[model samples]
Target: MAAGGERAKPAVQSRMENFRKVRTSEEESPLPFSDLPPDVVEMKVKEGSKIRNLMNYAMAQMELKGRRQIVFSGCGRAVTKTITCVEIMKRKLGGLHQVTKVRYKTLLEVWENQDPLPGGPAQNLTVHKNVPSICILLSRDPLDPNETGYQPPEPAAGLQAQPGEAAEDVSGSSSKGLKRPLPPPSEELLTKKLQVQGAGDPRGTGASDHQPDHHQ
Candidate 1:
């Protein structure tokens, strides 16, 4: 029993050490949190605050799963991966993703019916005992359903460039000629578009004009 206990201590310490490694990188530019523009810094603070709050909820709450609420929860290196992956996913998916911060109690409620128990040492330590340090949610609806959001298809080179500007110097442009492209429409938009189409509204011609592009 003494030898086994001694073995376990090293593993636990190893895990904690791995966790610290995830927080810092040997080669990376330092973020200019202090010198950044106020608005940019404000946004960073907001995102950081959100991540911290979500982590707190996970630590106190128990049991996390994917899909039901798109949770990103784990500790140490796992936690770092969760955060990095979620941010990338959000940017790539654009408005298709939604995020929410939930507590561990909420997790247990869904996966284990409020019972916080396990059949083995690993399960016992991982599920109910070890606190989660992060939680991220991605939903199907990042944008409101009632709003009209249409993103025009990307323009071919030279197709939409200014009269004298070279295509290489051209910036991102959509078919709609708008400065900002709207996110893809939600299910509600399709339904509304169908309704208008049936009613013979001229505006319902194509997916592009079916919904108004309202920036949120």
Candidate 2:
């Protein structure tokens, strides 16, 4: 009886598989493009033509917008989406379009070179041939006024300071102006201090002494 039931299950599975394949084939059938009305096709073509014309007009306006720097302010997601859309558009239309991907560091560098002052206008910008398809200016949320006018901290004065040594100022400052390095205590002195501390305390010096009695 078991052998018979196993054979019947295979037959049932094969039938179900055939039904699924038929259903999938019907669903995958191409749409009746030829059966569409002549008027409907003409209308769709006209609509597409109108849309293309509108896009061209908008692009022309953008190109003619002059050499003013554009500041886009939004949340991270919106800003990213805007940058992606701009990049795609630039890729479609090639020309003197300049799209620079500016990160926080690169943006600062650009600003430092062009205008060091806060919220100052960038100057003498020339579009090079190697400019990216998208100019992504990563910025904080525009809605949050607190983030505006904030500057990144300056780098440390000394780049090659040792672990125990005081770093000299590279900004033409006197060596005497640098902080004095404190001398490390001798190993023997440290050991003696530890021994004295352990003797005074009832608990032992090691970490195990500080551990709670697990038996309790």
Candidate 3:
């Protein structure tokens, strides 16, 4: 009876294994990109385009409206420098207000355009070029020194004047008057003072018996 029961257990185990279920392909998770809606994908691309446009418009507005100093700089290439300037201009405008009505321009397009600030006929107009990085102060004419009214640095005497001549003093007269120079120190006195200080005497007496007898 025991032998027959053991033989029946093996047949039952085999039947259980054969009946076990297997998962189908449909049970796996859906891919991330595949699950996104078609509309969402289209909107993402459009949003990128709008951001670019906003940056460009801000760059132009910064030159036209804000009138801030425009500085362009980048490593490696001129195109990179142009893009950096545009992007910086965008951020600066965005900080002031919401980015709206912005127009975007590519590096190649910006290069083909004239200098943002032109001379002569195109005063107050800017012309961008593929030259090295530079800080452009907006001016009507490149030759006009007073156009931008940029203050020249003052001289060491706290005066601003044309080169070669000293500035005018409080009397409105040119400061050409010769000022008295400082007198030189006597070296003998300076040496004596230094020697006394370096002697390191506690009472500061240089071999003088100025103290009373200690026994008293």
User: Which portions of model 3 miss their true places by more than 4 Å?
Assistant: 1-69, 78-216
For each candidate, give its TM-score against the true structure: 0.24, 0.18, 0.15
C-alpha local distance difference test of each model: 0.40, 0.35, 0.35
Each model's backbone clash number: 4, 1, 14
Clashes of 1: 4
Question: What's the lDDT for candidate 3?
Answer: 0.35
**Highest TM-score against the true fold, candidate:** 1
Model 3, 19: alpha-carbon shift in Å?
55
Best candidate per lDDT, number?
Answer: 1
Candidate 3 lDDT, 1-216, residue by residue in tens:
999999999987764444322211111122222222232211111112444554465456455565333322222233344455444543454322111111222222111112223453422322323322222222122223343323332234433243335323443442333332433478668767867875776656543433455434
> What lDDT, from 0 to 1, does candidate 1 have?
0.40
Q: Cα deviation in Å at residue 189, candidate 2?
A: 99
lDDT of 2 by residue, 41-130 (tens): 111111113434534543544456432222222222334444444444444443322223332211111111322236875333222222
